[model samples]
Target: MAIVDKSTLLVLGPAAWILLAALLVLAAAVWRLALEGSPAQMLVAGLRALVQLAAVALVIAFLANRGAWAFAFVGLMFVVAVWTSGHRVAPSGRWWMAAVPLAAGVVPVAALMFAAGVLPFNALAIIAVVGQQIGGAMSTVTLGGRRVRDELAVRRGEVEAAVALGFQWPAARLMVGRPVAGEAVLPSIDQTRTAGLVTLPGAFVGMILGGATPLDAGLIQLLVLISLLLVNSTAAAATLWLACRGAWVREPA
Candidate 1:
């Protein structure tokens, strides 16, 4: 079947609403049982995703054919990803700090991929690869930032003690935050390690469904996995460093 064939679109049309409803129902259950107050967030996130994805679909349809517009589109995606990640980590003014780790992770890898001819320097290819990399980096940054922030908040005494013991502020913060922040990469590590044995990622399955050879698909998936490792690790490290420097800490109440 074609990737976006009529049948697929038909399935997606209903599936979207059904999935959104299911998510809201699940969130409501959590809210009622666990008193988590997540139902409203779930509803808002679901609606936002629906609208944003619809917009992206229309935008891509128009821009994909225009080679000159590809970079602009990719840049927009990066900016949005950075903003979303930043906000996810910290809702306050420091949310923009996420841009540094995201760029640190994605830009270097994307540049190297293009320069080494691993990724074709074309609009579609760049968008596909760099978009995924940016997304992975964003996830890592969010995870790492939240982990470090929470750890520092909980272990404020430990950090203070280390500081009083002559450790610098950054070192004291890292002493308390680095270990937990490092956990941010665990998911990517597990996904990569279990790629073929436990799960076939979307890139591999999509390539095969798109008529690529299994070997080619596997190679492409491997590249994606490796790139994700680089991106996520860099993002996690950068986020941890930033957290150590108090770049994303909330003000005391």
Candidate 2:
């Protein structure tokens, strides 16, 4: 079907349902004292996210039909992922340099898969896989970046002491980097271990809902998970290398 002909299955009045769910969640948070924000901010953020997702959904559908548009959308996703991931990791103005490792992880694998015909050039599938890769890159970069920054900040004195004694940046980083990288891998490792037992990932559930065979859904989810693991590991390594190289250093002031 063409984009215009696709029906939005409004299960239980979309906006009203979302609003009710947000209200319920806000009420529960307040009742339980689970959060620190004003309920109004939560409500506003929920509404804004809903609006943004709706707009993105429409744009994605349109972009999926145009080859050039699909590539453009992928580029945009990568740029946003890099910026947000970098900001979350180190909070340095030079955090943008973290994009190098993020790209290092994503672009190589994505290019290989696309070139090898493992990932079809279809717009929808391309978008889906690219989005997953971007998400993986973002997660790795953000977690690893923050961990490294926090580690260095908390141990700067020790690091400086080592440096004073003639230890280099890479050696000083290695002293703390291993632990941070280990922590950064926990999310992916946990998600993989808990995939079908404790949680049903979106891709698998969506495929089942769309009438895919259980085996097929399982295989697809496996592919996604494996791809994510590789991407995350690569991104984490890249982040560590860049941070060690002083490319993403905190400001001296």
Candidate 3:
């Protein structure tokens, strides 16, 4: 069946709520059993998602005009992305630097897309495409930053040795951090490669359900995938560079 099927159960009404709650409960149970994860966290996250999506829908309806409101909302999203990504790597409060790498990754690609008309500069389309790219940047930078933090903590001696051998402190960090941080883009690469065969991504499926031809949906999906690669790779590299400069270096207790 096409994805548009199961409208009543999947899209609205009581069945949708029940099914979502059931799935969340099942996931929480499995996680709690295997990893002692907090089931409450899972439940809360689901609830938060429901509330946030509802809020987004209502807010987006008011942002139909192409004006300052659209750009302001996207700016808010960028700030949130930076904060969220930094929290993952810098629990000790050195997170503000996260904006650098994330901006480095997102700005260029977004400008290119806007300039090339790949994404129109309207409220809905701008948010949909730029938000996705910003999310990609956030995730990549988080992974890359965390890897740098962990590797430096674990391999402190290696970094120290390089430093003692007359290498600069930044270079020493780079020697240890680069290898691990570089793996940040691996997921994007894998997802792009196995996209249509293993899974239909949200953009492609959404467009198809919205009445776009399959070919048009596929092209859009392809564009999103390629753009994600650029965003992920650039963000990861910038994160690594920033980490090497001591942005996310593990602090001593």
**Can you give the TM-score per candidate against the true fold?**
0.87, 0.84, 0.91
Candidate with top TM-score is 3
Candidate 3 similarity to native, TM-score: 0.91
User: Which residue pairs collide in model 3, if any?
Assistant: none
lDDT of 2 by residue, 1-253 (tens): 2222223323345566766786867675784576665766666666777797898899888877676677788888888887788777656568688678778888888887888777887778878988898888888888888888778778888888888899997788778776787577688989998999999998898888788999999988988888888888888888888777677865476
Model 3 misplaced stretches (Cα beyond 4 Å)? 1-12, 249-253
Ranking by TM-score: 3, 1, 2
Error of 2 at 106 (Å): 1.3
Name the better of 1 and 2 by lDDT.
1
Q: Which is the winner by TM-score between candidate 1 and candidate 2? A: 1
Question: Better model by lDDT, 2 or 3?
Answer: 3
To one decimal, what is the Cα RMSD in angstroms of model 1 from the true structure? 3.3
Q: Mind giving the per-residue lDDT tens digits that candidate 3 earns over 1-253?
A: 2244542225565676678889999999998999899999888988998998899888888997865588888898999998899889886768878898899988999899988988876899888888898999999988888888889889999999998999998999888988898789999999999999999899898888788999999999999999999999999989988888876645577
Worst 10 residues of 2 by lDDT: 1-10
Q: How many residue pairs clash (N, CA or C atoms closer than 3 angstroms) in each of the candidate models, in the order given?
A: 0, 0, 0
